[model samples]
Target: MSTEKIKAELRTEFGKGAARRIRREHKIPAVVYGHGNEPIHLTLPGHDTMMAIKHGGANALLELDIDGDAQLALTKQVQVDPVRRVLEHVDFVAVKRGEKVTVDVPVVTVGDAAPETLVVTENATVQVEAEATHIPEQFEISVEGAEAGTQFLASQIELPSGTTLLTDAETLVVNVTAAPTAEALEAELEEAEAEAGIEKDEPEAASDEAAEDGDSE
Candidate 1:
């Protein structure tokens, strides 16, 4: 949970054209707001900010140096260009050192379950409250040697110090079930197709009839 240092410039420009201009210069347009303060528009180094987030995850803490005044902020919302896969804009929330913020932490699994068992993840992320500067990047759950029919609940997850789970305790996180055999899988697929009223195409007969009609014509 290290804070990344980002030098930012106060921006007076607004609108789409201005944002595009900023991005063309290898900078990203961003807004910072929180704690009863006015939203400040600024520009950050595009490559640096992107690298920090990639290394630190979504909850990356940032030490923003704006005109020599340093402020601590948390990465809140990020907008990206889907086609180009580039950072379009970002929103930061001002936070103090000891303040607790609620965020969704990604859930990751480690190890393997019993052989011939399928592992299903019910939740990919869980909400939690933690110190803004020390938010955990992710939660890891070990399923080593877990047998079939085993289930994991949110309450059973281990949290880091000073972190509290905000998700429902009864919520299912992971489930281990017996894997379907190849024959069973094929049967299930057939059943699903039947239920959906999907039938095999009778293209050969239709093509023969079309040829006969064309010959008669």
Candidate 2:
């Protein structure tokens, strides 16, 4: 992955109020830590940092200029405001250029399974180790013409050279299953109704018995 160059300012303020102030200024508060060093608090440009992450990834390389000091880091975590769709805080793990780090890479599916077979993904991402500066954008798995009951295991995936899988080799990643039929849907509905205390048909004589009891009272 290509490194995204961003410029940040050293944060002098702290706490939730300071963070809100930074967000109000359209900036994102972040901390850079790792390598057994003290975490440095900083504020990054909101738009630029977001765009960089969109193009790159959570583990993407970032070349930061903080107070004129060049820093090499990788984004470790990002917090967002769900309602406002704004970035809240970010965590950056400082690293050297040639260092290797373990990260979860998104799993992308390519191609379609065979007719009448549904390819169900069991995992959306897989953990792997790679150079911090050269982490993969994403990995794709092809399900072309896979039949029902076909399963793709983690060990079956072809990894890019130099990238090591950090997950279990025998872990199942995808499962192909046959789609439910109309009869199956009806049976499921009936079972659900029974479980929910729904009676499909009630005898009129039973209802009349309750009505007669009410009249007697």
Which pairs of residues have clashing backbones in candidate 1? none
**Each model's Cα RMSD:** 4.4, 3.7
How accurate locally is residue 104 in candidate 1, as Cα lDDT from 0 to 100? 93
Q: Could you say which candidate leads in lDDT?
A: 1
* lDDT of candidate 1 over 46-154, digit per residue (tens): 9999998778797888999999999998999999989988889999999999999999999988999999999999999999999998899989999999999999999
Off by over 4 Å in 2: 196-217
Q: Compared with the true structure, what per-residue lDDT tens digits does model 2 show for residues 106-155?
A: 87778999998878889988899998887888888889998899988888
TM-score versus the correct structure, for each prediction: 0.89, 0.88
